[model samples]
Target: MALFVETGLKPLSANESYLGKKTKSKAYRMYENHLLRVLPDLPLEPKGKMKLTAEVYYSNKLSDLDNALKPFIDCLQKRYLFNDNRIYKLEVEKFIVEKGAETILFRLDPYSQEGDKDYVPHPTDDREHRCPECGHSF
Candidate 1:
């Protein structure tokens, strides 16, 4: 299924501390509530490994891509009655846009390993590695 959200994505940050207990920031809480209100109901069946692809548009380039997934996935899990552990593949892309134009587009589908391949090595992968004990390249 596909879903689109018009509001800006909020990262799940460690910003709140109440008596040493962590709490979500007010902004994050508001964002979660907004998502719950706007997100459509999801099917309860078809439980299995799933794949999630998300295209995130941010107002600026200051946000880290990894931080945006948890909050959005959490909302999906809570509202859809599905477990996050069922997700076997996740792909996310980020784009920068003008303020107030931030949005997110995502899709969920059953995962298949048919086309999976081994990881490709980076260009620098063959470079000499440093020995942790001596801090010397070997």
Candidate 2:
């Protein structure tokens, strides 16, 4: 069985060309060809700006190994960053695994307010718990 590790990170500043965009989706060719070759079939959003900032999706299977993504991410910081190696923004956007590999869902802020959207029940989740209006849940 395989589990995925998807972290949605926002770009530090105006680093655009580094992250490609076909239309509204960020192109994963760089991600696929380089970082996550083990799972070549990682999913991505359509060509557009990601919800809050730029994001990349990666997948892993092993549970213990699932959390080993930190050092892998450090490679990005060291290799990229044209200036004086300042890590811009690297945070866990969300963490989930697809049992059926069908629909890929994660909470996003289309409007980017502190209290107006989410489906996850965990209290520690950054965003809101309810739909913020409709009050939906997973």
Candidate 3:
């Protein structure tokens, strides 16, 4: 699925980058609210690993990809789009949009572990138990 938001809001600064900045500016607060409002309702517990991709179309070429994506991706965590740790892969791309039109497109998909030999389920899985003592498998 995809969610779209208007472009041009700046991202939050990385931790402690600017020393002694005691307060969040109004613009930052507004940006946070806007992201929350635009984010779609995501599953509280994803079925499996997830892949998130964002396509940022900006009128200005100077916008940094990581800076543009941080606020939105972080909001996904707050809104339960899936934990950042569960993400198997992440993709972000930027494109120059027409002078007057710029927008951000967010897409997400669940990835199943079926057929994957390296898959190791979480401890909470209750599907079945194997008999280690006997030569039996469940």
Pick by TM-score: 1 or 3, better one: 1
Number of residue pairs clashing in candidate 1, backbone atoms closer than 3 angstroms, sequence gap of 3 or more or interchain? 0
Residue 132's lDDT within candidate 3 is 56
Whole-model lDDT per candidate:
0.77, 0.35, 0.69
For candidate 2, write residues 1-138 as lDDT tens digits: 344332334445435545675332243445434544342332333232223232224354434432434334433333432222232222343333565542223222223234434423323446534444555542
**Which stretches of candidate 1 lie above 4 Å from their native place?**
1-20, 115-138
Superior candidate under lDDT, 1 versus 2: 1
Candidate 3 local lDDT, 1-138, one digit each (tens): 344342223455566457775575698778778877877775544566777878988888997877777667766776664577677767788999888888788777775567556565544446655555663544
Candidate 1 matches the true fold with a TM-score of 0.67
Q: What does the lDDT come to for candidate 1?
A: 0.77
Reference-based lDDT, residue 122, model 3: 46
Q: For candidate 1, lDDT tens digit of each residue in 20-130?
A: 766789998999999889988765456778888999999989988877898899988877778988987888999999999988898888776665563233334476666
Candidate 3, residue 45: Cα displacement in angstroms equals 4.4
Q: Which is the leading candidate under lDDT?
A: 1
- Choose 1 or 2, whichever is better by TM-score: 1
**Between which residue pairs do clashes occur in model 1?**
none
